[model samples]
Target: MLTSIEVAGTAQVPATDVGFLLYKHPDRVQQFATSQGGATVFFPAASPELCRVVLHVDGVGAKVDRAEGMGRYVNVVPFAASSRLVVVLGKVFGDALAGRCATRPELVDNRWPMTLTVPSVPTGGRCSPAELFEPLGWTVQTSAQPLEPPQWGDSEFVTISLSGVHTVRDALRHLSVCLPVLAGAKHYFVDDAEVDKLQRLGDGWLDTHPRRDDIAAGYVKHVRSLTDEAVMRLAGDVTTAQPADDANAVPERRASLARHRREWVVESLARAGARSVLDAGCGEGRLLAELVTALPGAQIAGVDVAPAMVDRARERLQRWRGTSVWQSSLMYTDPRCRGFDAVVLMEVIEHIEFDRLPTAMSSVFDEMAPRTVVITTPNHDHNEAYGLAGQWRHPDHRFEFTRADFAQWCASVAEEYRYRVTIDGVGEPVEGLGAPTQCAVFTRDDSSPQLNSSEGGRR
Candidate 1:
């Protein structure tokens, strides 16, 4: 059970300056008690290149256990980043939230590159993370967390990553208000005082936000009177509010899909005891990043046909000195691609022409055969969820496969290559249609045909 927020700093502002802004000593660990639980604040990493301060709410499990009724037995407060966590944050960082930095007053209004990571925040239906945070000036990235035992399917809770250039005060205030709204509930009763608090936290930005009404309503627990009053007050105080550019809010669901794909692949690889991995069509190396972190001490590498993608991958994996990314196509066999414990092709097969898929897939199953192979692609059957009943997800996608179609193809490949394949769905499962993304995990069968340098596929 965990709930935490990380504040990252850049070289321009330096990590030390963040200490002055927050009025907390970087080296000291501070603890505070809240109505929900105890919160501990400390720096996990502090340097010129990057600085991160983590505020973690602990003792939540014990507190939940002591609560009365069904709340004690069935509540997400212990694990989900709920309104309780936001309230604790406000209490713990009161001075910082008010934009008061006694030691460095000038830094109070300065904007700097900052990123905040909230590991688990419940985003109920009715509003997506992009709709809520984007209007308030933060770029949002979210990964939906699956339910425990997994059979329950994906939960409403998501790990939210927000990045933007803004004063530390603005960022703190944004989270102070938005995180709770995203959580979609308040732990306490809502009243006029709550409206005042919401107005104060959302002072400058809420008036201009496209989802301001939703935010106001959600913040005050959906009490009609309070929501109306809060919205009116927000409308009146518009002096400092800047118009948000709604045109550029990135569609975040695709990012979530990519994350789900990566997590599935990594888990499948780890389950198969894969110590080394190669990402066959590793685009910009998003999967590579996950592999390095998830499978530490294991050899990791990625290959893409595009030179630009390879360059980006190289830069992205620079932090991991041992990992590598190179330019190579999955349709072709390269000696460098063989002999890894696992190889992954994530959201890639769809981009290849249908006729060339066999060649590309053969290169993976026959030539660069690994102990495990994980493949993920968009399920055409789930396209209706995206309002694209008969359309491709991406313009460049040569073809998309329905669940049955994907399964049949995987079965053929597994039989042809002499491997065992298990198919599963990724992302939230749609009723009757299954998950938005389909996955096929292939394990090499030792008793079957051996790996060889086949000449049929491009090299």
Candidate 2:
């Protein structure tokens, strides 16, 4: 097959090397990707369907350079409408320890099965797997994978280290405080130290010696430093007070701990007077069940990109046969889905790419014209109020927001899409963590000036 590779003028590879090399071996690769200068190479894929792609790194720092710059370094990740396998090859300069290269799940730990180094980028350069995973409902820290280690020492520890430095507890605390602060949220911090022991248990163990031993302590510390503290603090405060009891009370194997968060959404839906709703990106239809109960006559639909998630949601909503779920991309310009009386996107927006937010949100709030839309994104300013450094953050969230950021974005939407926006919080603020959440209620009036108009354009 014919291929082109970019290489430094000073190096072994050249940008304009023209050739179709004959290859007989099954494993022989026809294409190479590199940067001619700092990162001088681009290998166009034969098709978007090809299962795997490759990128190379020349030295030690280059590995970090590539890993830290994954989104900027290699090709954009392919999103699936169905479960399709795709391989990403980070063929490191053969001698480099594979440990330096990390994929999402690998980064949090210090050990791994040692695949060849491929400079894969973590989420959006804003956060890590450790930071985004928990909030979005994956169990990287408290759960298991084949390579999962009891401590931080046993995975691709480099990824976790990139976040910042702090002990596990300190990192989580810092994350709670900082995440909200960065979002311009208010009332985020409150000290749980003075509270009863149960809340402290989740926050205290990181300081224990036996607990801290045998892990990627340094990496753990760094991961803590990178989160939006304000969001964590505020959320923690609310969650503690309300105490997501359903999740904590469930059987361990179902892994339904997110039940508490889902229940909260159900309550919010009732208060909002939602008759019919779309649980965009609903995980297991946990919220849908409550909606079905509360509004028996209401129409409910669940949509998710992950088919497995859709399956779970469908199973949960089976009795309410009116509830339909399809595995479809929510990123389309005209999502082709009907707008409901209400749209609930709880704990899901943080997992999406920010660049695509305007388009996706517009599709729901404008083009489809839902009367009421409720969204909850972590409040960044809340993290700062606690003055804690190092904390809890989810690796999947593209960006969390502060109250001002949320309001500003909502205001912009109102100005652009003709929606009346209101802001509310799920729980009270910590002394300084900021509001745990900045829940925005968007109400649109169709007869108003359209979003694309000059006076309301997204400037």
Candidate 3:
């Protein structure tokens, strides 16, 4: 009975930063005790080009008891990669998986090309590795490991090798959620906390995943009630809608606010005479759908980091001509966003860390160099009016900005990128506090001359 997990990869990000991201120094090994036994995490190889972190679990002391009549029999629990290992992985690298790296904040939103290898994973079912990961854009290769006795046939465990381009957080989250699903069993009992665990780890990609139900079932130990609840919640249905006066407001109000934001974004773009648009960080194609209807003749394209979101966007906009959706990260340079008349970041910038905003904005203004850029974010000043001060509207938001803060940032970006910027309020204004949403429209100074080619123009 052996239990061990290895995450080896060459990341496009700095090697030293990888250690900080994982919250473990590469030069030393850290050990933590588990109920069954204990686990050790160490970086066997750390370099500028490659790094390998291994989690080795020793289950020598683990035992299960069985009772027959008055006599009790005890046997050692099988220690192939199981839910225990997943639990340990979460404990060891939880911060990295959650996209929190205080030491190297910029890398939090960065998508780094990586190669991940899990030496042994218990896949009780016959499902192929490709079936589980390929849809998420991972290139997977699996090899079965045989049982000790040839007559016993092959074991449930397999060595998995995966290569893909993903943010470090995305890669870790995928492993955290999928590993337990692949194992198909948990050594410990499952409870309500398990449901919360599944949802938290599966945040961005789970709802629209093809095997979502199966993953949910596996995570909750196939408890039908728990699985049903998780599935409904993931599909955005389980939670009750609060009334408008409630601190958080109702789902209807939230939807209305989103609709208002999208409308204002389209209005600004139209006002600028933008006929070809790029919707950066477009989640689920909501704004893209609005763009199609509001600007009928415009060429619209949307890009998001989550494949599920991109897939949903594609489905939603399939009937609209000159509309396209794909997976991309605004934190990195993307050529597809180039040559657009305008790029819209509707209620998306707040989700990115403050330190990473410069990189993302530069990628859009410096690299893509669109003629106009429209951005919107939650106005923190209005939070108090809603009785939600000191709290963010969304769990993923790194920071909500006040009207002044937003204006200052926009002014700085406009000047740095050689654009004239105007700040405006969106949604219904609240006296001196202004609207619940703040927007900035940045128009490039044609006479200033761009460092890059000016392919931007009204289509």
Candidate 4:
């Protein structure tokens, strides 16, 4: 940690949450990364005589982009072993960032300015308090909101940024770097004037409160509340699609209604912090598109062995970006894709060959690695639930697991996957509601907060 620094030494910047004196130590970074259960991060470092920043990672090499005078983002694929973030920034030869750390710590924010025209705000990660009002100290408190996918082919992007500082100016400066991300919201710092504005807002807001430093926290809460309200309001307008025309459109109509229902359903789940989604034999791209819409910027994806379903998913999600979709059998290998924030395994889990249920589900969990996997199937115990009898059978359902049977199956897998499990079904029992639809929701002990806090949505 010491060898990489320039002779002048680094100035310390105090942070309420993530405070550390940053200095050039490219060499020590490799060691630090290894100590953190992370793979070594190797990237080119700027000349020691000029600027200083440290970089480390879990991969052989990362693509490093320089930050303002110093700092850089070492972009790499996520590590499956752990979620810890590894970053490196510094000057590169013949490029900028070749200087000592700024002496004027006053560049920090104190102002409390609001963004004038933030277009297409990314979900979960709009802007960290630091990036939103750079030059003004700031802080952030985020809550996830579920969304829906319109088309499988649509490209959707969501970013959840954070600012863990005490002043408004600092938050704004941080925001400047992250908001309006399409314009390259990579990195930012606050100047003195902006910092002053933030401090004033903090002082003025707290002037009305018993505690002075409480201003930033209160303001962040208020703003987050408003944001959530706005999202919920938008949700009220979306509903199940009405009946369609053409007899051939029957299947299409059912698909359409399901799509609409998916949006609200996913949103409701996200509000409660559900994780992981499984399209249980997601047919075509219908539910997949809806899942994308419902969970903006989620780490969610879809899988179907049918060539048609895979193609349809790709098409349906062309525009709604971020989450990736794939074509693969639920019965198969390569354990990296299993657990997730949540799983949607909707209608497909019931039909597989009976013996395959345990193995298939285990594979799904192992591949997706989600905290929770949401399951839905008809209530075989309640014939009136769906108006069916023991004699009746759907051509598609090979075998239906009773609530008890399903619970046991899930329990076995939970044990195998090292997760604590819980079960719940979709919809409630109404006096005249037709069939008893059953759903099960599960969560692993290790998954709760980590999945919930991830700045992405799942519905």
lDDT of each structure? Answer: 0.76, 0.44, 0.74, 0.41
- List the candidate 1 regions with Cα displacement exceeding 4 Å: 1-12, 61-70, 237-459
lDDT of 2 by residue, 1-459 (tens): 001111111133221111111111124444334322121223343322221122332222222212222464462222100000011121212111122222232222221111111122222223444453334222332212223355544322122211222222233232332222222221112332212211232243323323121111121122232122222332342233334656556222211224444655676677777788888878887777778887778888877889989998888877777778888656774354675778888877778788888878777776667777777766665654334333323535577775556667777878787776666664435444545555666776755532221111111
Where model 3 places Cα greater than 4 Å from the true spot, the runs are 1-12, 63-78, 245-459
Write one digit per residue (lDDT tens) for candidate 1, span 340-377.
Answer: 98988888899999999999988998899898988888
Whose lDDT is greatest here? 1
Count of clashing residue pairs in every prediction: 0, 94, 0, 104
Q: Give the per-residue lDDT digits (tens) of candidate 3, residues 59-153.
A: 65544323101223343233555566666667777888788999888877766667777756877743457877988899998888887888888
The worst-scoring run of ten residues by lDDT in candidate 3 lies at 450-459
Of 1 and 2, the candidate ranking higher by lDDT: 1
Error of 4 at 9 (Å): 98
Error of 1 at 429 (Å): 46
**What shift in Å separates residue 385 of candidate 1 from its native position after superposition?**
36
Which 10 successive residues of model 2 have the least lDDT summed?
A: 79-88
TM-score of 2: 0.44
| TM-score of model number 1 | 0.49
lDDT of 1: 0.76
As a whole number from 0 to 100, the lDDT of residue 287 in candidate 3 is 87
